[model samples]
Target: MRDARPAALGVRPAALGVATATTILLAGCSAPVQLPDPPVDDATRALCTALVADAPATLLGSPRRATTGSLAVAWGDPPITLACGLPQPAGLTPTSQCLEVNGVGWWSQDGVTGTVFTTVGRAAYVQVGVPNSYGNTGDALAELASVVADHDTLLRPCVG
Candidate 1:
């Protein structure tokens, strides 16, 4: 009875093993993460395409997941999604602060899914949707920032 209690509270050892195996299998055979393609001009599309292509294959130790299109991508189980060539963040203002991650500027907002970060002070707006399961999004942002810095034009310094 006591053993059963532990299993109910957490999970049975056998069940845990099965779940782990299933996770591994699902990782390899994952459906593409679907994100809305933003409406942007040809020049913005070109910029975003370069940034998306330049993004690393891995983020926060998780391999990039299959995503729907060039405008957006995702990674890991919970799926950290990145989208480029977006409109300016609605919450942002002239006085808003931009946090620098690996020299790229990002402005953040707490959303239902997690923390949503939009790139500031650049030629194109880039958004990263990070689920709370990933904990600190900084690690994930740093890698993506490198891609942005490489591919996008810097218009103004990231305002701290």
Candidate 2:
């Protein structure tokens, strides 16, 4: 014996409320938040050279370095080469273990100086000095990892 008039007229407040709530919920879940790109610095040139030298023979020469503020990046393949700069080999303090990622050597300074080294290939390595070195180590390493991973992809395409 329930009334069918409201359903027929399409005036159900509960249905409208549900629709409005769903719309608002979807709006909140729309898109992912993105982090801003790190800045590039003038010293990135040196960093690129060191990294690219390590590229596999197939990569010839392809590392490019760019720096902004305290962050430095080295990228490229084979002969192209890239680097932020080379840190002074003798002056590094409390040197940490060198991490081997995909056969490439990556090192970091564990102090406030925030210096880092990355091997791009067999005979190439690059150094970088970052600002606020203490807090930025993770960011610096992540950036290097991204470049290294990309190089691997270029040299060895994913089959799956």
Error of 1 at 65 (Å): 1.4
Off by over 4 Å in 2: 1-88, 91-96, 100-104, 110-112, 120-122, 133-136, 149-160
Candidate 2: tens digits of C-alpha lDDT, residues 1-160: 1211111112224545454344334323432111112223444433343444443332213234322222223222101112433333443223435555444455544322234343433222344333241343444444545455543222222221
Instruction: Give the per-residue lDDT of model 1 (tens digit) for 23-91.
Output: 335545686654546678999999888788778888888888876567877788766778887677665
- List clashing residue pairs in candidate 1: none
What ranges in model 1 sit over 4 Å off? 1-29
Displacement of the residue 93 alpha carbon in candidate 1, Å: 1.6
Error of 2 at 15 (Å): 76
| Ten contiguous residues with the weakest lDDT in model 2 | 1-10
Q: Give residue 109's lDDT in candidate 2 (0 to 100).
A: 41
Report the Cα RMSD per candidate.
11.6, 22.2
